[model samples]
Target: MKIAWLTLCAPLLLSACTSTQTVGYGPNLEPIPGSITYGGQPRTKLTKAPVGSIVPHQFFDDFGHRVYETYVIEPDRSLRLTSRRIDYDIFND
Candidate 1:
């Protein structure tokens, strides 16, 4: 009984250990060399848009904190994106 519960809980605990790393923009900022400014996997080097995708997306900050990266894909397939960085401290930080 205890073993079964532990087994079931192990994966959940392990998955929570996942971490995020900063993509240092200052060093690699020359138009990102090959970074797709839009139509990518939200936060990685991926180029394909997400399935059933809608725009006005989001992302994170330098410390892997939450941020919003908004984008819009027009009917004619034109892409427009903007990034807004927000810290966890809402009022004063």
Candidate 2:
């Protein structure tokens, strides 16, 4: 009886722990200003990088904000923007 109950509950507990939420924005999303993909998705595909690879890009935006973006290479050779971080030089660093 205990083993049967454990077996029945195990799948529910495991499924609850599995994450369905994405880490960040999905692919082909409208780019936000100061992001690397603000203009559009890059024409060059990440042919060399493997799927699920994390790529980092950094640059300064039009308003002088430093932008750092993280992307994951997809199976189709497109990049999915995962997360973006912006830092303003408030202290002139």
Best by lDDT: 2
Candidate 2 versus truth, CA RMSD in Å, comes to 12.4
Residues forming the 10-long window of minimal summed lDDT in candidate 1: 26-35
**lDDT (10s digit) by residue, model 2, range 1-93:** 999999999998877543233225555545567565668778888788889999888777676666677888879877678776666554443
Best by TM-score: 2
TM-score list, all predictions: 0.31, 0.59
lDDT tens per residue, model 1, 1-93: 999999999998876555333333222322122223533433432246653244554554445455544444444444444333344542222
Q: List candidate 1 stretches off by more than 4 Å.
A: 1-54, 82-85, 90-93
Clashes of each: 1, 0
